[model samples]
Target: MDDARQPGRAYRGRRRAQAAHTRYAAVLTTAVVGAGIVALGVSTALPEPRNDLSLEASGNFDDVSVRGGTDRAGRSRTSNPMSNMPAPDVWILPMQRYTLTSFYGERWGRLHPGVDLGAPQGTPFTAVAAGKVILCGWNGGYGNNVMIDHGDGIVTVYGHASKLLCKEGQLVKAGDRIALTGNTGHSFGAHLHFEVREHDKPIEPLAFMRKHGVDIQKHTEAIYG
Candidate 1:
């Protein structure tokens, strides 16, 4: 009787253990599958990675603009549409002259550095372009002088003036009278000494005037003939 009861009790215990293991295995499998689903959902909800890094510098990576991009050589490019455009047109002859007294070059064993136009004393001399008067006073060798800044490193200097009509810092238009012709500074007679300078270096005033659309030769011929 004792042996028979022991066998029955062992069989019941083994069945109960099997059932408990099956329930635990089902719960573990369900938890693992739920965690995998949640991870997949989170990955899908995130934003996609971008391949074009053109606007990374500006922090506008998603904004694709038409102006900035690669050129034909695959180098980076930027837009500057007006860089090659022509400068503004404001040209005029500084004064009516009787004759060209001295040219802009070596003279008397020294550099003349300007053009001398012999005109009647007290004749008004005008500005070649619209600008502001940077200097107006009696300079040492230049005598009563006037200098105008016409922007873009261009400056026009008028020396040996008998009188200055415009004061320093005064804004004047093209062809405005700025001074009067005179024999004030190291001069032999009444005339106007005009100089066109680019970045403080003197350039030929006649050629510079002609290049800016002022016909200096035409003005000379018309005045002479």
Candidate 2:
């Protein structure tokens, strides 16, 4: 009986030691996991790495290329819009006597999408082509403005006017007087701010007019000279 009791006591002691070892191992694992979490937090709090490389060292980010002008394989691209317009054979001059004050393009970091023609106040300016008047009213910045849609995405804008003679939706001939020029809206002096848009994108008005057999420079020289 004494020998059996001794063996039982020894077994109980061994079980207690194993339980304590397991508890110690669990505590150590928890501590290591907490330390790893703290290390991850400290690393994440640091600032992001900076790249001090220039554009030349990296790549050209400001390169602007015309859309639809080229393809991925370095081939010329072409497009055919369903609303393409027939080229006009002739176009009436917008003003009888005026000077080319400003041109259309980048001027002082801003895109001047139209040409400015300086004419005397109350000078009647006619339509450059026959079209239906789309807009005629007191427009913001443009003041008394007029817009004529000549179909096929071809549109003309007459801005900075003192008086609008035609009404919206009115059909006008090429030489019809649409408005009287004046110092209105954002104008410095009396002038007719004209614009030609092809599918709503502004293009060089001089080139457009010249393509229609209307030499704007010659007209300017004829009047101002």
Candidate 3:
């Protein structure tokens, strides 16, 4: 009887040891799994790394060969909504016979998106050319403004007016009065602020006009003529 009890006691002790080992293994596995999940979350929260184009490389970003201007295997890139404009052929002058207070591409301590033609308050403003009115209303920071979409990826914008006479979608002729010059919207003085956009990008106004054969010097000549 004593021998049998000894064997039974030894078996019971072994069984308890096995159970403890199994419990420890389970706890270790849980801890490892939890740490792995936390590490994965931290990795996911990190921002993705991107390569910024250098200033020198920016000029070449539009090249048809290196950039997306070409297809996967050297095919020509097609521009969507391709400009249907009549080669940007139009003559534009500020509504009033005013001085050029600010020209395009000048760093005015800020991004000057257009040219400023200084006119006295209430000077009659007109359309630069014949175009359909895309916008003729008050806009944020552009009180009593007008925008003309003459098609062909070219658009003309006039801002800071005292009043808007034309309605939205009205067709305007060259030299037609569209509004009155004023220190409205965001302005330091009374001026007719104008912008010409080619596919929404603002380039030098006088140079662009010259490239289109609309002589900027003609403004002075026509005034004298």
Q: Model 3, range 1-225, lDDT digits (tens) per residue?
A: 011111222122112212323433533443344322110000001012112421211222133123222242122122212223221123445442566887665353444667787777877777765566656766545566777655545667787888787875465555556888888766779887787767645556776666643444344212112
Error (Å) of candidate 2 at residue 61 is 29
Candidate 3 stretches with Cα past 4 Å from truth are 1-90, 106-108, 213-218, 221-225
lDDT of 3 at 158: 82
Query: Residue 87 of model 2: what lDDT?
Result: 24
Cα miss at 176, model 2 (Å)?
0.3
Sort all candidates by lDDT, best to worst: 2, 1, 3
The regions of model 2 sitting more than 4 angstroms off are 1-89, 220-225
What TM-score goes with each of the models? 0.58, 0.58, 0.56
Give me the displacement of residue 202 in model 3, in angstroms. 1.8
Steric overlap count per candidate: 0, 0, 1
Candidate 1 residues lying further than 4 Å off, grouped into runs, are 1-88, 220-225
Candidate 3 has its poorest 10 consecutive residues by lDDT at 38-47
For candidate 3, what's the RMSD?
A: 34.4
Model 1: per-residue Cα lDDT at residue 51:
29
- Residue pairs with colliding backbones in model 2 are none
